[model samples]
Target: MNSMTRIPLTQLDAREPKSSGPQQARLPSAADVPRARDTQFKDTHGRRFSYLRLSITDVCNFRCNYCLPDGYQCSDKTEPLTLEEIRQLAKTFAAHGTRKIRITGGEPVLRQDLPEIIATLKQTPGIETVALTTNGYKINQHIDNWKAAGLDQLNVSIDSLDPQVFQTITGHNRLHEILTGLDRALELGLSRVKVNAVLLKGHNGDQLNRFLDWVKTTPITLRFIELMETGQNPDYFAKNHLSGESIKQQLLANGWQQKIRSKDAGPAQEFDHPDYQGSIGLIMPYSNDFCSSCNRLRISALGKLHLCLFGEQGYDLRHLMKENKQTELESAIRHLLQDKKASHFLHDGNTGAIQHFAQIGG
Candidate 1:
């Protein structure tokens, strides 16, 4: 495959094995399944997984240009996993050496029982971190309850520092409200707080200095994620996708020191500055060796296990999430790990079944 060549979705689909029955058919026999070394989850590529991104819902209020620009449209009528199912899955992951669990959604706060969900994960054994990723639509109203539920970290999406630009990008003029909520979250002493922004070529691309200035005084990590090409919106992606390397180079030249990534950390490459109170992180998925340190697995709101965000397909795990299926669920998860690809084929323009970020809580 050449750098400029893109594999068509039809051709990609033809290359994958067609499944007529349930996804469970792909699972290996219990006797044939290889146990992870040290009882921790290790894939065929030697990557040890200890982090899980669990999406509780696919509903969102924002219409961000990069993700759900047309706003959230419910295509899958399947009910999201119940609270008990989420707890069971969290417990199973934790028992397998998973230390961190990030709760995500189209907007997790939309779930009225989110605080309870946080409390459930926090109470799970072997889990050390319970984080929430939200658009900050209701953080100001629910931060107190969320913090009291033992939420350890919070990541809010704030694409642009300028109010006008923010509204233009998200179709919402609540930046003031969201920023105020962040301040309240900080005041409550959350262990970690971060702001996420997608790097768009023309929209917020030139606002790097504005973002840097805000982070200079705020004690929060601001991450700029490179726009990725998905199944849908190839035209929009081509027009707006910007590389994170440019911003990284700027930070390095300005004396911002790159921090060593922790084993269980997310993909972002963090950078710190002596004079700034906060730091910067760059998530460049298209970069070389981006998936070498893969440590997390994604579970969609409907309980499908996605090995990679850009993988060809997801495996159905909801059927094995029954109360008495803990052992079976663990076995299924372990068996499925063997099928995880060494790396996603995003560089080849293969976005798998992901039409947008909201589908899998990107």
Candidate 2:
């Protein structure tokens, strides 16, 4: 482990040590501020935001080409929010009607206390789902404990089915471990285990048939994500970027049929194979703009609330937490929610802050 990624034991203890009851003082009521008429996290545009993606740490073991640049440096300058802090933060959001929470990271499982963290979030009154998005490297060791800790769903990133191709893309040769972990998760009766594959034009593009073949053997959903501009090498993105449309056409050509449009909370467009037990999801951030139905708010590891993934600015919740003012925290969150950007500028020709996906928590 890198020195910068290590959390101080004292600070961890201050996070209200696990055995103790809820460490955070009860949130002060926001009675003075009139509750917004519709949904809690909704903005003026009528978009009801319920999903919150919280990144537990910015340190990643693998330097995936699509998410981080080569020779990327992890900053040890700042301490990430402690688990107790995340608990209080989730409480604030749940109080405001955010029901679904996805715990993310450079790799969430890298955090030793992640199972306990999931248990903490699950204990939150209004939090209905406590899901996770991981690289699947270390999940096998903790799968059973995590499920026992109240983890509801999982989204594991498997860049390629071929070991050599996966090694080239992720700069890691642990494809077998990831696959084994996924198998264990499914066998454990995990209700939803979505395999996320980032589609690189000429790289793993040839393996779609194999992926579909594997899907026929399982009930887990497979999601293909389009490579987007995430501040990595522009040359790399331009060369590897595969549009969801092309992939969709390929799927249709292979006999996969579109499923009826149902009300889904997230952005993936769904398609299914009649003979298979599972379905396929295409996340075309580059080809299709799903911001009109965006219902997510992301909190980076250091405690900044990012309203839009590509938005340039974020409100600092860590500072408010330090101040220990619940009313002010809730007020600031609402103001920031109301000021959420109407659309993401990630599409071609428009660019905001060029951020690495690690910093923003993918």
Candidate 3:
């Protein structure tokens, strides 16, 4: 809608690979690869996708130093996909083996229709889970309504437990309010509730014990995600990119055991400890073979399909999103899956075209 280049479905097979740098291994051409069956969404590498991350909006209010330190600025004038568009997209994906749908955004609560969106996903035939990732700005006021609307899982971004440090990181002092909302979600009988903290060096990198102590008593999974380098933050990444492998070693030494990943689980390597009431999860995108078990796909706030979070481009599926076009939409999606790469090139210092996490709901 903003005049961005929309890669048509017809050219999916004819388009050449984006790059052939040393970091990128020469993958087989699209013609040489076997296409996935129509019923299931499998890629050329034998990876089957069953989870969808749908970003409803790219507008956020946070001014975190690592992300939008300068705050959000609108680069495009296009409006995000409407509620009907999102509902149709979700139904299509659910029909094609997508069991879980996670609603994300710059802060998804910014959308007033979020409750209806959650309810629609829950009522869809093949969807088993409906999750939302938010910054918790207004969770206290909305959690009750969300739960009643059939929200199953919730992940809140709480970067630190220390109030002052939290304020410094998120540019807000609502830790108490957010934590209260998190507890309320548990009390409301939500199946799962998790906390996500992006590990930033010189900020919360040395504060693992603080997180561990809190999770020791709380019945929740606290996840530490390694700070990822985006197109907009190479300098910040260089200054504060902490590795999760160090945290993994520390957990192992402390007697935490790695758990087997379920078929539809996220990218985090989860661990459990007998002495703790909660669990720990580490999302180290830079680690070896990190993308081997990818089971999720991302759809932007616009209707483009992103095969990988760090891929070079997005394929436009909106053109085929009209009524009675489910057949064409499904075919376009399946054809695009054939070109998904074996892995991301993050290890090679390539962050692809992802200017920021908000763009694709990382």
lDDT of each: 0.85, 0.76, 0.84
Q: Considering only N, C-alpha and C atoms within 3 Å, which residue pairs clash in candidate 2? A: none
Clashing pairs in 3: none
Q: How do the residues 1-362 of candidate 1 rate in per-residue lDDT, one tens digit apiece?
A: 00111222223231152233322244444566656468887788989889999999888999998888889877556678899999999989999989999999878999999989999999999999999999999789999999999999999999998899999899999999999999999999999999999999989989999998998999999999999998778999999999999999999999999999876666889999999999999999998879998899999888878788887456667767787888777887787777788888787877777778887788
lDDT of 3 by residue, 70-136 (tens): 8888988778888778878888898889999999988899999999999988998999999999999
Error of 2 at 278 (Å): 1.6
Worst 10 residues of 1 by lDDT: 1-10
| Number of clashing pairs per prediction, in order | 0, 0, 0
Sort every candidate by TM-score, greatest first.
1, 3, 2
Question: Model 2, residue 195: what's the lDDT?
Answer: 91
Best prediction by TM-score: 1
lDDT of 2 by residue, 1-362 (tens): 11222222222221121122223322224663467675376777878778899999877888887777463576465777798788888888898888989998777877888988999999999999999999887777888999999999999999889899888888988889888888899988877999999889878877888988899988999999988775455777889888889889988998889877655457888888889988999988765557777888888888876777776434456756543666677876775565566777666534444357777676
After best superposition, candidate 3 residue 303: deviation in angstroms?
Answer: 0.8
lDDT rank order: 1, 3, 2
How much is the lDDT of residue 83 in candidate 2? Answer: 82
What is the Cα-based TM-score of model 1?
0.93
Q: Which of 1 and 3 is the better model by lDDT? A: 1
